[model samples]
Target: MPFASRRPRSYASPRALPSARARARHGRNGRSPVTGPDLPLAHTRLDAFEATVQATADYLQDLWPDELAALRIEVLPMPDQPPGVSGVARWRVIPQHRLVVLYRIPIERMSRLHREDDWHRRLMVESCVFRAVGELIGKDPWDLAPDRFRHW
Candidate 1:
């Protein structure tokens, strides 16, 4: 029989929805697609470094609770070098601003030597922050809290 309208008829099927794996792989409509277990996202260099600094600072605060209010940790893209030599980190011990600044680029360069292993990079950043903070506070990092860092 001839159809009255020119439009094609729609057909319903059993497989109306995408499979679970498909849905997981490609999110709803055009957002960032989610990778499967084979892949994972990593934090950017600056973010990871900042986190490392924060973690170390928290560790310090736990030991020296009274001193937490006096110290500040800062991260800068690059150090204020005399000319061509951008150093790893610096500290400025002012009245209200006892700041220990970590230079991102130099430290990233140091991290790259470890082939981008997150744990190694985190340790590197924390160590850098620890030494700088210790310098600003006039205490040896090993002596910051000897009992807390026996392995270190």
Candidate 2:
């Protein structure tokens, strides 16, 4: 069959990229660029950080495996929080990938986990859950829990 003669002309074949433009930006391998906006934003206030953690717990509870439902999602406050740290946040992640810790660190510092950021080194409640959540939604944990769920 000829290209234009097909009944349903798809934008791109399964093996092809979304479009030439996207391919140009994403590179020949067709991977899209990841950025801050791509991250999930879960917002909350400083005083409400614990609540945010609970909500994430509930969210994870809904998705929990039979063996892990009782396995509580750990939540710790970042004392002396960095200047611009998200007011309130916690992490929830799909358990399979197990890269939550790896994902939490900025990409530039991924290779050097122990090398701490001057501002963040002290005031960061690091968790594997946040990292995994970041990986799942392609955004930082702070972005995912933008606020305590009104309904939760």
Candidate 3:
């Protein structure tokens, strides 16, 4: 009679999921016992993009200490481009200020080449920023950035 009415309970939110320490103590599987995979909700891609730009900026500042004041960093939604050709800007460099204009959408699109990997997406953003700076200064981006800066 006691066992007749008994039923298993369930957890609604992932927050109720067991912690690593708890799991280890109980000696359960690494993943959630009920759920197949332990995958949780993902964070925003905007935060990731911001972190990439900040990292790239820090690297550039380290590379060129004195010249940092002269160059400007601009983040725009998308680069001004012709319908088919995106090589929109005709002017070689800004007459007064050297600028690196990073178009978020275009770079994010390029980052889709390796959808799952974060390093690839970040590298794309960094490389795009480097390329923009190179265009402003009229130097090859490879020459400006370390060989390790290559993106997938």
In the range 1-152, model 3's lDDT, one tens digit per residue, is 01111133456635765677866766755644453466664556765775677677667667766655466665556656658874543222463656555666667864546455787777777877676666766667787656564676
What is candidate 2's TM-score against the reference?
0.24
Best candidate per lDDT, number? 1
**What is the TM-score of candidate 1?**
0.61
Query: Model 1 clash pairs?
Result: none
Query: Global CA lDDT of candidate 1, please?
Result: 0.64
Evaluate model 2: give its lDDT. 0.41
Instruction: Please name the candidate that would achieve the greatest TM-score relative to the true structure.
Output: 1
TM-score preference between candidates 1 and 3, better one: 1
Q: Estimated TM-score per prediction? A: 0.61, 0.24, 0.55
Ranking by TM-score: 1, 3, 2
How well is each residue in 1-152 modelled by candidate 1, as lDDT tens digits?
A: 11111234355635556666666655655334377556875566666666677778888877877765666766667666566655544433443566666676777674555465777777777777677767777789888868865765
Q: Give me the runs in candidate 1 sitting further than 4 Å from their true place.
A: 1-42, 84-96, 111-116
* Local accuracy by lDDT, each model: 0.64, 0.41, 0.61
